[model samples]
Target: AQSVTQLDSQVPVFEEAPVELRCNYSSSVSVYLFWYVQYPNQGLQLLLKYLSGSTLVKGINGFEAEFNKSQTSFHLRKPSVHISDTAEYFCAVSPTARQLTFGSGTQLTVLP
Candidate 1:
């Protein structure tokens, strides 16, 4: 069985504040981790991924996450967020399950 869990549904932070989005997963076998961001009505864009290398992986928009095998978690973090960072973030997993399964989602609201 494979599943993804995002602890928070919404995160409100002032502009230039740091933020962290939590994500956990369970799978019988190895899996590929991914974080995607969607702005308003725009399509989802790849934020980061954990394939088969270093635990710390960096992606676009100054976002990054570390894959913890023991904890089975991959949490996204950003040092300072801007108003443009306001959007929805989703954590996903891709095993041999045919397709990727996404988390409920985390809506990041950055206030000016």
Candidate 2:
């Protein structure tokens, strides 16, 4: 079984500020980790992924995440956020079950 948890339900950040969204997962076996972002009234888009190799993976829109196996965590970070970056972010994990388990999501509200 695999489960994902997003520590924060909502994050408020000022424009051009840095932000970090914490995510944690638990699985019995190896898994692929990912971060996705969804804009208002839109679908989800892949932000970053961690399948193997480097723990620090970069993604679109200046987003990045580090895969920490020991801590079972994959936290997403952005050096600078804009008002357009306001969206709902999700952390997902794919275990052997052939389905992706997603976190509750963290809503990012970038205030100008």
Candidate 3:
């Protein structure tokens, strides 16, 4: 199965702090990358995707990631985080179907 795994179940950071959401994946042929964020009691929103080209990809809300083929991983990073950034981050892989195989889930808490 084309799947992705997020190592961190939860990440806690103070307001204006930096944070990272780690993600790894395993696929046979090819796959599409996606990062979704979910606020409290809300549906997931597409944060970013890495379809092709440059390994380093930038996303919304000052977030970015680098696709490392050798490491078989794609990790999200933010320089300075805000309280609004507090939410659940999910790493997904789209192999063939539109349905994305999501990670367990990660709760990012930004304290004020």
Candidate 4:
């Protein structure tokens, strides 16, 4: 079984400022990590994923994340955030294709 933790429940950042959303996972076996973003009144969208290969994975909306196996962390980073980037971000881990674990979610609010 696997579980995920999103360190911050809410993150407020000024527009165009760099922002990072921390995520950590715990599992006995290897798992696939994913980041999903949900805009207001919209469904969740895939932001980034770490399945295999390069530890550094880039996703849509100019967001990226680095997977650290030893630390069991997959933290999302954005060099500059825009007001449109405001959304609810979720960190998910899947031990298998059928089973997925999700974090509490982090609400990122970009201020003008």
Each model's total of backbone clashes: 0, 0, 0, 0
User: Which segments of model 3 are wrong by more than 4 Å?
Assistant: none
Q: Which stretches of candidate 1 lie over 4 Å from their true place?
A: none
RMSD over all Cα atoms, model 1: 0.8
Q: How much is 103 displaced in model 1, in angstroms?
A: 0.4
| TM-scores for the candidates | 0.96, 0.98, 0.94, 0.97
Each candidate's root-mean-square deviation in Å?
A: 0.8, 0.7, 1.0, 0.7
Off by over 4 Å in 2: none
lDDT of 3 by residue, 51-96 (tens): 9999889989989988998887989999999989999999988877
* lDDT (tens digit, per residue) of candidate 1 on 1-112: 6899999999999999999999999999899999999999999999999998899999999999999999999999999999999999999999966789899999999999
- The superposed Cα distance between candidate 2 and the true structure at residue 90, in angstroms, equals 0.5
CA shift of 25, model 2, Å? 0.3
Query: Which pairs in model 1 have colliding backbones?
Result: none
Error of 4 at 46 (Å): 0.5
Q: Is candidate 1 or candidate 4 better by TM-score?
A: 4
lDDT values of the candidates?
0.96, 0.96, 0.89, 0.96
